[model samples]
Target chain A: MSLRLVRIDDRLIHGQVVAGWLRALGARRIVIVDDATARDEFLRDVLTLAAPSDVPVEVLNIADGAIRCIELAASPEPVFVLARSPRTVLGLRQAGVPIEVVDLGGMGSGPGRKRLHKTISISPDELAELRELERLGTRVEIQIVADDRPIPFRSLDSTH
Target chain B: MGFGQAALIALGYYLANSPWLFGLAYYTLFRPLVAGLLVGLILGHPAEGTLIGAAINVPYLGFISAGGSYPSDVAFAGWVGTTIALAGGLNPAAAIAVAIPLGLLGTLVFYGRMSVSAVFAHWADDRAEKADINGVAFMNVVPGQILLFVISFVPVFLLALNGPGFVKDAIDRLPLWFSDGLVIAGGILPAIGIALTMRFIFRGSAIPYFFIGFILFTFSGGSMSLVVIAAIGVALAYLHLTFTGGLAPKSTEAAAEIATAPVLMTSDETAPAGRHLTRGDVLRSWITWSFFSHANYNYERLQGTGFAHAMTPIIRKLYTTPDEIRAALKRHLVFFNTEPNFGNVIHGAVIALEEQRANGAPIDDDAINSVKSGLMGPISGIGDTLSQSTIAPILLALGIGIAGGTATGSSIPNFAPGSTGNVLGPIIYVALVSVIIVGIGYVAWMQGYLRGRAFVTDLLRSGTIDRVLTGAGVLGNLVLGALAAKVVTLYLAPTVSIYGAQLNIQASVLDPIFPGVLALGLVLITFWLLRRVSPLWILAGMLTFSIIAAFPFFGPGPQNPNDYSYQACTSSLLHKYAPCGVPPAPSAAPQASPSPAASTAP
Candidate 1:
C-alpha cells in the first residue's frame, strides 16, 4: 500500500513527475528501476540532482529494485516508482513484486516506435511487453498528469 | 467591432505566437491580462479590457504547457474571448465563463498547428540533405510562421469581427436562470486554477508556508496587500533556507567525482588540434536558438527543425565540404525538445562537441546524439520545474495581485467599471520576465560552451539550482496561498434556521472563526479532488453546482449585489429578468424580488 504510484516514463525524475505527481500522491521517496540508469554513474548523479533535496531517490537495477520495492511496500512511508519502459516493469512483476496498476505516463517517439496514445509511442517489443503486463493481472492506463483521465491500454487500437 | 480593429487584434495574436520577438511575446503579449489591455485599447476601453483579461486569467494561474502539450490555450482565450466580451459588453466574471470554454477549444487549434508543421520539418530535412543552409533556415521561419499566422490570425480575425454581435444577441435571449448560472460559475471557476498550482508547489514541509500565507491574509482583515504578504514570504523563505542549511554546499563530493572522471577516448584515436570556434560564433548560435527554438515546432520532430536552424552559424563556420555540411545539418535535425531557457546548456555542449568533432576528434554522430537525448530529459526536468512551475507562477501571481488591486497598498475594492488599478502591473511583469529569460538563456548558453559537457554536472553539483528551487517553492506556496485568499470568491449562500433566527453561515459563523475559511476550504477540496477527478469534470461539476445553488433559498445571492460594477453588468444583460437598474431593498431577501420574465412566461 505504501507503493503509491508505478509509472513508465522515459524521462524519469523530470518536472511533471516531481512537481505534479509526487505531491499529488504524497509519495516521499522515488525509486528509479532501470538497468541502464543504474549502470551509468553520471546519469545517477544527474537524476539524483533533478529531484528535490528533501526526497530520497534510489536508482537500482531490476533485481535490486524489485527487492527494494517489496520492502518499501511493506513499510509505512510512501514510495513512487518510475521505469523507462514496460520491460522494466515486467521484469519487476516477474520478480514477484505485487503490482496492481501500471501507469504509462510518458514514452517519447523514437526509431521503430509506433504511437499508442497521446505523446506515448512504444516499439512493438514494448507493446508486447505491455500486453504481457496486462495479462499478468495488472491494469495498464495512460495518464500524463493527475488532472488527466486515465485511458486503459486495452481500449486503444494497437493495429498500427 | 470594426474591420480595422478586428484585423489589428488578429495581427497581435499572430505576433504573440510568431517567433519574431526573440520569444518575449510568448511570455508577455500572449497572456490574457496583457492581451485584454491591448484589445481594449484597440476598441477604446482599455480599463475594462484589463479587468476582464485579469478575470479570465484567474483560473489559469497555475497553467503549465510542457513538451508540446497544453492543458488550455490561454493565448487564444485572451485574444478572441476578450474581444467577444468587450464587444458584447459582458462583465469580467461573465467574460471568464465564456473565456474558459474558448481556452478549451484553443487546444484543438494548437494540436492542428503542431500536426501540420510536421510537413515543414520534413521539408527542412530535405534541405539539409542537399546542404541547402538557406533552405533549412527558410523552412524553419517562413512556412511555419505563415501557417501560424493563418491559423492564429484568420480565426481570431473572423471571431473578433462577428463574435460580439452574435454573443450580444445570444445574451439578450438567454433565460434568467442560465445567465445567473454563468455569473455563479465565474465566481467558482478560479478555484480550479489555484488547485492546479497547488498540485505542483504544495508538497511536504512546504505545506505550512501555504497556511501561513492564508492565515496572514485572512486574519489581517483585508489590511495586508499581496505585496506585504509576498515581502513576508521572501523573509520567511530566507529564514527557512538558513535554518535548513539549504544554502550550504552539500554536493562537493559529487562535484569532485565529476571533476576527476576520466574522459573516454579510444586507444588508437589521435588527439588532433581542431579549428577553434570564436566566442562570437557560439553567441550567434545561442541567439538563434533563444529566438527560434520553437519556430517550427511540430509533432513529428518537435524542435528538430529549429535545432538545425540554430546550428546553421555553427555548421557554416565549422564545415567546408558539402558532405560535411550535410552531415552536420542532418544530425542536428533529429527530434529534440526541452525548456528553451535552461535547456540552452545542452545546445552549448553540443556546439562544443561539434567543434571538437570538426577538429578531427574521435567523437561520432552517436556520441553527440546520445548526449542530447540523455541530458535533454534531466535538464528539462530541472529547467521546467524551476522556470515553469516556480518562476512563472510566482511572477504571474504577483502581476495578477497587482492588477486586481489586492497587492497594492490601497484597500481591496470590487472591480469597478472602467477602473484600471495600476497600469504598471503588466509592464513590470513583461520587463522582469524578459530580463530573466534572456539573461538565464545567455548565461546557460555561454556556460555550456565554456564548460563543455561537464557544465550540467557542475551546475547541478554546485547546489545553486537546489537552493533556488527550494527558495522558489517556499515563495511560490506563500504567494499562492495569498493569491487564493485574494482571487477565489466563494460564499456559502444558505443560512441555517437556528432557534427560529436566520444565521448566515459565512457572516455569523465562518467569518468569526476565520475570514476566508470557506474559500480556503474550497481550494483545498478542489486540490484534493484533482488527484482522482479530471479538471474538465471538476469544471463541469462547479458549473452545475453554481447553477443549482443559485436557486431560491439555496445558494447565496449574486456575488456582488451591492457593487456598482455588478449592477452595471446585470443591468446590461439581465434587464428583462429583474429590475437591475433600481437598487435592491436593503432589508429584503434577494429572492423576494419579483421577476418580470417569470410573470410574462405564463
Candidate 2:
C-alpha cells in the first residue's frame, strides 16, 4: 500500500504540494480525485504536468478515482491526493476512508475571511468545521511549504 | 432522476456528511497548474495549458498562501495569461510580466466559504455511489470550467504554439479596413465584463460622481487622468461615506424596533423577509463613516482583499442565521476580482440570495458556490482579459502613441491604468474598468437574485452558457456600433496643397474623404463589410497606413499641427561641422584645435 497523503488545499498542485509534500515524503505519484479535474482532458494534462516527472499523476474525479485508488493501493507506489478546498477533505473523511492525519497546507484568504496565518483563513464556520474534525481526532495542521513545523488546526483560533 | 441523480444525492450526502475524501479533493484536484493543464487539454491543447500554468505560476511564483484569504489571481493569470499568450504571438516573458496585474485582478473572486466547494464534492460522491453516470460525469466535470480549460485551450494552444506563422500570414492577407475594425472592436470589447460588474456595485450616491468623473474628464478633453479621476472616485466614495451617508437615524438600535421584525416564535429561530429589515435597518445598511476600511464598500473586484471588508459587517450583524451567516460568508469568499464598489454588487446579491435561503427561500450554498466558481473562471478570463491584459496594455499603447505623436496608432497594441486627461489613455482605461466593474456587479447581483443560489452552479452546467453568450453577442454588437461611431479615430493625410489638385493620384481620388474620416469609415465599413472578420485586420490597417500615410507623411517629413509652421531645430552636435563659414562660430573657452571658423580663417 502506498503512503498517500490525501489532502484538501483548494490551491491544488501548488508549490506547497509539489515542493513541500511530494519532496519530503518521496512520493512518486499524485492521484487527483475530483470529477472536474479528472474527466477534463485539459485538467488531466495539467495535473499530469504538475506531477514530478519522476512521479506520475492520475486525475480521476470520484467515480473513476476509485479505480486508480484501488490500483495505487494495490501497488507499491507512493502517492499524494489533492483537492482545492476543505470540503473535499471533509467528503473523504465521511466516506470512512482510513487516513492517519489531515494536513491543512494552504488556502489563500479572500473576502469574508479571518486570517489563520500568512496563508490560511477561515470563516467562523470553517473554524467550527475544523474544530469538529479535531473532535473526530483528525490531525489538522496548517503549513505552507513542508519545512516549517505545522500549526495544528485544532488550536487555530488563539494559535493563529 | 434515475441512477445519476440518486448517486449524486448520495455522494453529496456522504461527502457533505464525510470529511476524509473532502481532504483528498482539496489537496489534489484543484491545483492551479493541474487545473490549468486540465483546462487546456479539455480545450484541446495541453501545451497551452502548460503555458498558462507557467504564466499563472509566475506572479504568484514566490507567493505563499498563508491565510485562506489569498487575494492573488494565479488561477486567473494562468487562464487568461494563457488565453492571450496563446491567442497571439506575445513574448512569453512579456506575457508573464504583464500577467502580474492581471493576476492581481483575480483578487476579487473571493470565496466567502471555500468549504462550499466541498459541499458539491460531497454531492458528487453521493451521486457516484448511486451509479448516476451523467450526474457523476457532470457534477465531477463542471466547476464552471467546462468551456475554458475544457474546450477552448486546445484549439487556442495549437494555434499559438505551432501556428503564429500561419496567423501572421493570414493577417498579411486580410482586407485592410476589416482588420482595423477588429482592432477597434477588440479595444472596446473588454468593457463588457467591467460594465456588468459595475452595474451592481454603483450605488445611487456613486452615480453623480460617475457623471462628475465623466464630465470632468471629457470636458478636460480626456485630460483628467484615471488615477486623478480614480482619486476623485475614491475621494467621492469616501466623502459620500463620511458626510452624506453617516449618522442615519438608528431606529433599529431600539430593541422594540428590532422586535417589530416578525420573529419566528417557533422552537429555535428563523426570520421572515418582510419583517427582517425595518426602515431603520434599510437606512443603517447604507450608513457608514469610513469609505473603504470600515466595511461599507466591498473594495471591489480586482482588489482581491475585500472578503474581510464585506464579512466584517455581516459577522457583526449577529442576528443573521448560521446558515445565512455561512451562506453570506461563503458568498464573499468566492474567487473574484477586486475592482471595488462596482464588483461588490455580486457580494450584495449573493448575500441577498443567502438571506433569502435563510428566510426559508429555495436557494442554498451548494448552488451559490457553484455560481462563485463559475464566475471565478470566466470573470477571471474576462477580467484579466479586460482589466489587466487588454485594458492595461491597450491604454499603455494608446498613451505612448498619443504621446509619441501618433493618434493613428491601432487600439490593440498596448495597455495601462491611470487617472487624467493629460494622457487620455489611462483615464479612458480607468473609465472602462470602472464601467466594466459596475456592469459585472449588476450582472452578478441580479443573476444571484434572479437565479437564486443555483446561478453559479447552473452556469457551471453545460448548456446554460448559450444564454450568456447570446446576451454577450447582443451587447457586443451594440458595442461594435459604439466603437464604429466614437472610439476609432481616423485622420492622417500626407499633404494638402492650396488648389488640392494633388500630385498624388491617391489623394485626388480621396479628396472628398479626409484621412481621419476615411480611416473611421473604413473601420466601420470593414466590420460591416466583412461577414465576420477577426483580429488580423489590426496588423493590415497599421501596415497600410504606416506605409502609405504615416511613414510617408510623418517619418521623413516633419509633422506639424494645423496652424503651426515647421522650423528646423538647430543641431547642437552639427555645429562643429557647420560648413566653412558661419558667423557665431567658436566658444570663448577653447575651440577644438581647428574649428570650421579657424580652418576657414587660416
lDDT of 1 by residue, B1-602 (tens): 68999999999988877788897776888788788778878988776677677777878877887766688998888888888877876656667788888999888878888888988987888898899998999999899888888888888899999988787677667654555566566667888988888876787668899888877776776456777778888898898889998755546335677766644321234434456678899988988987888889876677888899999999999898999999999999987888888989889888878877887877899889877876777888888887777787787777776666432111222232323445555666777778988888898888887776577777777789878877877888898887777766665534557899766666578767887787789999999898878788898898878766555442223343223223221322211121234454332222211111111120
* Backbone clash numbers for all candidates listed: 1, 168
TM-score of the first chain in candidate 2 relative to the native first chain: 0.80
Candidate 2: fnat, from 0 to 1?
0.04
lDDT of 2 by residue, B437-518 (tens): 4455456544544444334333322222222322232222222222222222333223334474423322344423332234
Give the lowest summed-lDDT range of ten residues in model 2 chain B.
Answer: B593-602
Worst 10 residues of 1 chain B by lDDT: B593-602
On the 0 to 100 scale, the lDDT of residue B543 in model 2 is 33
